[model samples]
Target: MHTDLWNTCLHLYARPGVERACLNLQSQGLDVCLLLCAAWLEQRGVRCDDARLKQLSDCAEPWQREVVQPLRHLRTQWREASAHDEALGALRGQIKALELEAERTVLRRLESLTQSWPSDQSQGDCDWLQRMASLAGQPDCGALQTLRAAINRA
Candidate 1:
């Protein structure tokens, strides 16, 4: 079995600058987990299309917008308070954990979406980064540069 998309994203995001890059992209409304799964699938030569893009969007957005982002935003809002209030810090920590879990749930959905794609290594040279960047509506230079650098490193 291939390494799961969640594990792949976790590993890749740990690479220097990747976490920052992902956060930068995420702040701009791009779904980093879905992008990582797209990279994973494209690496395996899987194809992408509108329907697939919609599926990826459908898979990633609700949880991100509804669950993860709210938890994250609330946690971020507490950052300063957390410094002064141990109780606030603890609550933020728990919310942070829940946010992480919500993200992991999205990653799992992305992984499941790509699992049935045909395994053909030659087909993977797709411009997934460009596709994602374009899909994001506003092209963020830092985020695109980060993804491009990461993909080239592969």
Candidate 2:
């Protein structure tokens, strides 16, 4: 199982449809870091327990909410203006870098939090998806299923 959370995320996200699925879920208020962690845990065969899920969520939520999301918002909102304004474009680039750093930090924290978890027998992909969905406040959706499938393929 891949223990490097950031690298694992990059690899998984490079797969077809995975990025779209993640962005869709994120737009719906799902924490992408949490989703990625859930996928990694599932890949590792770690049993998806409530306490573990809560721990991971607690670790990532604050950083994602405070740091990552704001940078993402700024960069995304500036996309059109940035194309026309050099200064705004440069600022957007910085924000994008910061957003990436914030995500990396969160992924690193997640990796540390889960590193000690011993791999167990396969508890199935649906198990982690259900737990993630519960935490994300997302009802069953095609994107969620796609994410689960993409993660396993990763």
Candidate 3:
């Protein structure tokens, strides 16, 4: 398994069905970066608790709202127009890259936030994925299942 959250996300997202599942979950109003971080924390055996959950959410929400979401919205808004205009298409690609970089920045922030947290001390009930998914209002989503299965395989 990848040691870092960014690499883990890249690996997991490339796995069969993972991209689609993640996108589906995103459509349902879940933060894909947060979900990936949850999976990484779970894999690392990090103990989950209310406070940690809040910390992660707090750290991610602002960045997602202020940085990532705006870039994504701009890229998405340009999609149709870009298809018919070469200049717009190039600009959209640039925006897409910026969006990805913004996500990477958030992932780095999350990793740094948890850098001092001990892993492999989690109790059986400390499931970060479940907690995050439930918090995002998708406790029983099939997309969540797909993520779970993918992480398990890893």
Candidate 4:
């Protein structure tokens, strides 16, 4: 298993079906970075509790809203016009890169937040992904399961 959340996400995302599943979840208004963090915490055996969940949400939501979303909105807005405009396409690509970096920043922040939490101490009932999914909205169970299975495989 990857030792860091970023690498874990990289590995999981490269796995078959994981990217699609994540996109599906994202379409349901879930933050993929936050979900990825949930998978990491679950794998690390960190106990999932209300306080921890709130901490994760608190750390992720603001940056995602204020930083990542704007870049994404701009990038998506340019997708069609960028197809025909070379300079716009280049700028759009840069925005995409910024968006990715913003996500990485949030992932790193999440990792730092949980760095002191002990592993292998989670109670048997801890299900970070399910809990996070439920909080986000009614995300597809199959998508959540795909992420869960990928994490388990890793």
Q: Model 1: runs farther than 4 Å from truth?
A: none
Q: Model 3's lDDT to the true fold?
A: 0.91
Candidate lDDT values, in order: 0.79, 0.84, 0.91, 0.92
Task: Report residue 36 deviation for candidate 3 (angstroms).
Answer: 0.4
lDDT of 4 by residue, 22-93 (tens): 999988899999899998988888889999999999999999999999998899999999999999999999
Candidate rank order under lDDT: 4, 3, 2, 1
Ten contiguous residues minimizing lDDT sum, candidate 2? 121-130
* Tens digits of per-residue lDDT for model 1, 76-114: 999998999999999999999998899899988888877
Task: Show the lowest summed lDDT stretch of 10 residues, model 4.
Answer: 117-126
| Best by the lDDT measure | 4
Question: Which window of ten consecutive residues has the lowest lDDT sum in model 1?
Answer: 121-130
Candidate 4 off by > 4 Å? none
2 versus 4: better lDDT goes to = 4
- Taking all chains together, each candidate's TM-score versus the true structure is 0.90, 0.91, 0.96, 0.96
